[model samples]
Target: MKSSIVLGLGFGDEGKGVVTDWLCRQAQRPLVVRFSGGHQAGHTVVDGAGRSHVFSNFGAGTLAGAATFWSSYCTFHPVGVANEHRALVDLGLAPVLYVAGLAAVTTPYDLLYNRVLEANQRHGSCGLGFGATVARHAGPHKLHVMDLFDDFVLEQKLGSVAAYYRQLGVSFAEEVLEQQLEDFYRAVDYCRTAIHCTCGRAHFKNAADHYDSLIFEGSQGLLLDQEFGYFPHVTRAHVSSRNALEMIREYGLPEPQVFYVTRAYQTRHGNGPLTLEHLAPQLHPTPYETNVHNPWQGEQRRSLLDLNQLRYALSADAQYAAGLARQLVVTCLDQLDGPWWVSDDDRRTTLDTVSELAHRLGGHWQNCYGNYGQAGNLVAG
Candidate 1:
């Protein structure tokens, strides 16, 4: 079976969604697998017809008639799924999602607590209970997709999760908690009609044999990984190819065709140490920009590409990426109106084209694709 993995090399918003959509549209029958992160993912995809969708619960390939398989490492939010399902329906697309039974379930309490925590800590959260859900799963009070099917089990687990949050000093008013529970159950009812649960690894194995191609769409970026990224500013999930590689090996799939994606420049959302923050104004804007200034994630930051950090990320993933056919995808090329500005250690270089940028970074990648504007338009270099 042909397997492809799309990863963001820098701090996200690197056009991974459009890249995944491109891969799906090219494949005969593609199954998009979410191997990490959760409902907090904001992968924006704009179709060739100018139809735009910022996929959170659904895979980025959903717009291309591709089925999504949410892996066990990911989290599931029933309310978010219900809302995104309706949104996709409104856009004239039938989204088919199969969530793993062992996937962690996020609740409204987790949502509220996440916002409260981010308000004080300001750790660049999407404020969608992604980290909170993962944190809750580690504790005694846990909820999973399997429990969502049984109402009695779901309610009991949710109550325990609420008490666990309360012990962490997060409290909610009686009516507030009641309303949150009401909306949660209502969303759960809608989700039951929309989503389907699977037997985790077994189902994934079947999918690998059934579909002609499997596109593993990863969330965030390599720099935001819980282990590799800077502390306190990193995400709770494994944004690297580690989780995806593990799943591929367990399922006995062939070596994956890994596509490491990044923008022509650098961009980061929320609070973090951006390499060249002053060069933000020098970059041009794209037509399908999805990230906006929000109270939760704050402003979407920008800078020139840091080749040093890109090399660091490549080294970090090198151990797990052995024997994998890898390529580089540089997106947002249309945003670069002038010379390609890239920094390497103490020195900087001004390259004329994407190929020049690739050459300066060494011979790690033999093939590179540059994306111009939105709509998943890619040109191989």
Candidate 2:
């Protein structure tokens, strides 16, 4: 009955993978539950042995021998799954994956449309068709994980999806479309053999009987939630604890221990408003940095940690997280040159240590963890 939820307190890159990896090691058998977002997530984990991986299609705890469950709120990409499955197998790890039968499925057409749309509008898309896939499901055309195993239904839905995008001014050569379709079918076949498609709700209700613990892994961050974020630039999913809490309730689980993670500083990718971005000193990029400049997501921007913004995000999540035990995890302590640089309104303050910062944070946390490198330790009381 031991379960916990890991959420990013800011715009991603919050070391969620690192925290989840540590949590997985603590449990005898852990099931990583993905409740929001999809393959667009790029949670990176570095083992003590320095073995590193940027998890996308699979949960961050894959290398820790934890099984992953893609909930109904997530989107499934057959191609992405197939590629990641091969990569993990090559690493000598057999990844166990389960997908909700009703989870939205991403198709080649969605990827094409997403790329074209981002090129025209530049709304900071991840260029993985995650938002487009969710949008398509909301419309007349739809595809699901279970549909992939059915040729007739998959074809009908995929054709409509292609036509729908074509009407939206996204065009591709017939030969290119045919090749993409061929590749997609092959990917689906590969995924069919590797994935276990099941009813998300039913599986969750009985998950505790099969697994010793559950680790609910959230995607993106609270600020990027579709309902709370600053529109346009926001992700198409609720990145908060809302979805996770609902699932817990439906499964008749106990109040989960919630770990809200953030870096020693603030960061954002693509395009959006980031407080103190221009005022803070530009940090020299670390050699082990996972986020880099790209055409789709632009540059990964950083700034001094804004205490006000952190409070705001926590307050927003508090509504959905009432009665749950909460913890604070501040990562990248090694990146700080001296004390913690924090921004509050027009004034900048420095905290001499993580303990001081946690006290200044002024919230009731069951525990606080400070992460300097790959691992996290409890802040000295």
How does model 2 fare in lDDT?
Answer: 0.85
RMSD of each: 1.5, 1.7
Each prediction's whole-model lDDT (CA): 0.85, 0.85
Residue 204, model 2, lDDT:
72
The alpha-carbon lDDT assigned to residue 48 of candidate 2 equals 68
Off by over 4 Å in 2: 173-176, 281-285, 375-381
List model 2 lDDT by residue over 195-260, tens digit each: 999986778767768888789999998888887887798999988999988988887876799998
Q: For residues 126-226, what per-residue lDDT tens digits would candidate 1 score against the true structure?
A: 89888999988887899989898888998799889978987888787779778977888998999887988886567765765578888999999989989
Task: Give model 1's TM-score versus the native structure.
Answer: 0.96
Shift in Å, residue 362, candidate 2: 2.9
